[model samples]
Target: MKKIVLATSLLLLTVCSAQAQIASAYAGRLQSVLDSVGKRFHIKGLSAAVYRPGEGMWTGAYGESYSGVPITTDMYFPIGSNTKTYTSCIMLKLQEAGTLSLDDTIGKWLQNIPNVSGQITIRQMLNHTSGLFSYTNDPGFFTALNSDYTKVWQPEDMLQFIGAPDFAPGTSWEYSNTNYLLAGLIIKKIFNEPYDVTVRRMILDPQGFTNTIIYPAEKRGTIPHGWTVMTTNGPLEDMMVSANYDNTAFLSMATSAGAIVATAEDVAKFWVALMNGKIINSNSLAEMKQFVSINANNGYGLGLFRMRPVNGHVVYGHGGTCFGYLNENMVDSTNGITIAVLTNQDSIDNNQIFNWVVTALHKNTLQMAPLSIAGNEKADDIKIYPNPASNYVDVNLGTANNAKFELIDMTGRNIINTTVDGNYVRVSLSDITPGLYLARLSNTEKGILKTTKLQVVH
Candidate 1:
């Protein structure tokens, strides 16, 4: 008995050692992918962080914050429109506390200059279905912005550029920063304080996000300078010194739309906490995720964007672009994975970098643990229906007992896996984004059985 116990303990230790080595190997591969992408894009600097359910968190930074400052995980970057997510979260929290209702109109909350009516609801504003014109689209707006980079802009001044509605309220979808500016106004009116004060008390302080700030004018010079090109192919220019990097002019007007700055790690942590239901109630979160289809594969939720990538997994988050910064934060809710990518230069292809990093991580996961069953059965006996599924798919394992199944993406990443209780097993595909997937079944005794393609549409 003593010899048997000693052998079992040794086996467990060996398994733990092997797992640690695999994790270390994957971390090295992830860093390599970041380095390659940063060099290819000629990004001034790039910072990213990832959090997996079981693996905890990992962060990487490449290139320079400025000419000589090496980018670090703790350095702040302007998250741009990602501030919409925070603004929307604040609204949902207010609704949960009975402070306000999503059905409330802008006219009810604050006085407006033009086209204000009861038809426009807070829900429509949050989801970009308000049909309001985007102030940023005006050519004269840019002309003025460039002419006087130091001129402070009030919310009403920005509103003057919104000449007309894009379409009837709630009749179409259009992204408009004006909607969020109004949302900020409503927040201030309700709390009887500045928008930033409420944001800090409700979100930053509660989350212990020490690195996240509202971009105060006094500390503008303390942050890393934003870089952008002056002409089509000109050399990089320092936007801060040029009076363009979150200057008082832009910050005063962009309050709720684009004026938040945070480190990559803090961004990832915020999403993780949000996903785990630590920040908002489950019902509020559900309301936030009520996605409105923007296109065949993209959707807009309250403050978040629901995207179905080529890999078929649904990602929830937002992307931001300011004068010289581009950033994105994505959360794979199904797998509890969060990724935050931030760059100091707007020229970088942020989408490519995000996709490459996720792909690398998923590929490493598959390599570390390849899914396989025991036996060697033929590959023609299993059936999956409906062939094109929307919500759920049923798998029929004929004449095979105790089978295991997996739903894989085109990239060969195992997205979902489970065991078959009897002849038929029902798998939930509701959380998955609309795309193509592969269903595979194998018996414990039969090794390999069958594979079939699946199409999901909603």
Candidate 2:
């Protein structure tokens, strides 16, 4: 406990010193605001951790991990939907290994998955375009969630919603747990192993992430964490949620789906690992990043969520939920900011905190990409094919070489950074989340600047 407290205090000092160029009051108030958040939310024993770039690491616990005992920074939490992004990563890793194809139809891997069309590609499932039924919406989902919800759920057991199709694949997008469940099944079939094992082998083990978990049903008695009690009318109760359960129940999410646990720090590390080409083969991981539409979380990609704006830069991550708990986590890998929050509360302040933390972090983040076109060169030449692409994009520089190209979105952060050595440079824009982005190219030596639109519609 002394070591942990010392480490946390050092992180605070680091953040303060690193941000000295900015201001101390800014840092102090930011920390204060987090505590205020705990108080405002009636947050009991809540924990918040951040990994700021070029500064001190910050992690502190308030309230308790539960009402009875003290919660520390080292303790683990479910991290909810944050697990989905990892699930998506495993699928991409499999594709890179030639065990699966992003374009593979659902019927190709799982049994009795009624194919609305033979086009329900793995890409669509990860991007939530498969239009499958969201198992969370099933009343039976909640009914089972409360009583003996710890039973081990095989992939097929979770896929019982295959009786009808919600919409034609890729016609419209809807978040469906069935998609992830199928993804998990596909992983199992491809790797001849359990989904949890495959994910750890691919993402967790490679990155050395130790705090997250995928609850297994058989280990019910050992579960950690709590839930906030709330009625449909929303009353605050000093109750810990179902922290203990059979960890195996998490398997129901399938290998390619949403069953994993992690700390805010691990979430940050994984985002950076994925961005820095440390998780899987660079080419395949890039494919996983291609963004997709998820109306609920603003937008989605292969398996990520484009959460919000930070220093006018886009942030990426995912939020999650299970029976009695709500979880939300986010990361802006480019700028090195990560936020993870776990709650036993029946509901959470995902939107408010997302904005608050982003605002605080944005104020301290350096080199916030400026989205200015007033004086910049207007680019009319050069074209990049497959704008909303799933896997890759082809850039035609039109005789221009040795230039830098940037794929910038509304937040002004360039999602893709590449240098042109030939007339055409094919960049992998997948693996990242999906959304609208602009392609900017500049030859500072030649004093030439060109901008174009690039979309990855995978």
Candidate 3:
């Protein structure tokens, strides 16, 4: 009996150790994904965090905050549009308390000028089924915004810019910032206080989210500079100074639509807490997940986006894009894994990277090869004949047989996929466009074994 007990104890210990290692490995792979995204997007900085149910959190930060300042895990980012999620949470909490209902019309809450805006239901506003014209899409609004970025905008002022409803309320779906702006107005009317005050009290303070801030007034100390590129191939310019704007004005204007600033870890924690039913009841969460098709390809829930990537993996989250920042906070409801990616740059599609992160985390066993010096050495062995191939490229993998090669473009799209049978593989780049690409070599079982930069020149 004693011998049997000792053997069982040893087996249990080994199993626990293996589990810990697996968790660590997942964390490593997540970091690699973040690094790759930052490089590909040409972002000034990228900060991300991943949280597993029982395992602790893991954070990864890459690139510079400024010209020389390296980004840290604690840096703050403007979570544009993600503020809508928080606002929706507040509305749900109010519903739970019987103070309000989702079916309530905007006319019942606030004395609005526009009949169409007032007739829009709260549910329609939250889910973006409201037909209100997006104020952000207005040419006059952009004209004013570009002229004076520091101009303080009141919610009432924004209403003037919204010309008319696209259609009747709830008839169709469109992503309108005006809907969220009105929602913010309703919150203020209900609580008899500023929307930011209510958010801080109900969400930020209770959750102990120290890094999250609803920018009340413009002060730029801890926050990293926001950046924007003129074109896909253009250099990044500092919007803070170049645009001659204070973030406070932009924050005030964005309010409940796109104003929340938070670090990656805090965003992940917020999503995890919400998913675990710590914020609202399970019923509210269910309502939030009750998705309606925004288009044939995409779906929208209450302040949340339901994404079905090419891999067919479903994730619920929000993507935020302000003047100079783009962010994504996603959750895998099945496994309770949360991923938050925050960047201080604009115009890049972060969904592809976020989807990859979700797919990798969902797999039973994360099949990733070493992405360090060892992997680089293996990549060095496989040589491409021309440093910059014009039409065709020859990859000499030497003894690396049965390896699969994938040529991925800068947009995170796989442009080519072929298999290597023997020592050498010839690839025709005649049809391929002249640009940058990543050549990834891997096997069926080991996942990505090696990756190298490949340049195509016309």
Q: lDDT for model 2, please.
A: 0.57
lDDT per residue for candidate 3 within 1-458, as digits (tens), equals 00000000000000011112225766666666656545544556777776654444677777765665677777788888889999999999999999999999888987756635667789999998888888777777767666666676776777777777798887888888988988888888889888878998999899898889887542333677776654445555666766654576767778889888888888988998886567888679878877778766568889988765524445678888777777887775333457787776664555544554334444422233333322223656777668588888887875566676777665334577778887678899999999988776655333345566789998
The lDDT, on a scale of 0 to 1, for candidate 1 is: 0.70
* TM-score-sorted candidate list, best first: 1, 3, 2
Model 1, range 1-458, lDDT digits (tens) per residue?
00000000000000011112125666566566667666654556677776655455677777665555676666788788899889998999999999999998887887755755546899999999998877777676777666766677766677667768889988888888878888887898899888788889999899897778886432432345667766665556667765444455655567788888888878888888786566887678878888888998788989888877735566788888776677877776434467788876665444754665545544444344333323433334667889899899988876666676778665334577778888888899998888988776654344345666789888
TM-score, one value per model: 0.73, 0.70, 0.71
Candidate 3 has its poorest 10 consecutive residues by lDDT at: 1-10
**Cα deviation of 186, candidate 3, in Å:** 0.6
Q: Write the per-residue lDDT of candidate 2 for residues 35-100, one digit (tens) a residue.
A: 555555555444455554333345545455444565455555566666667778777777777877
The lDDT for every candidate, in the order shown, is: 0.70, 0.57, 0.70
* Superposition TM-score, candidate 3 onto the true structure: 0.71
TM-score of 2: 0.70
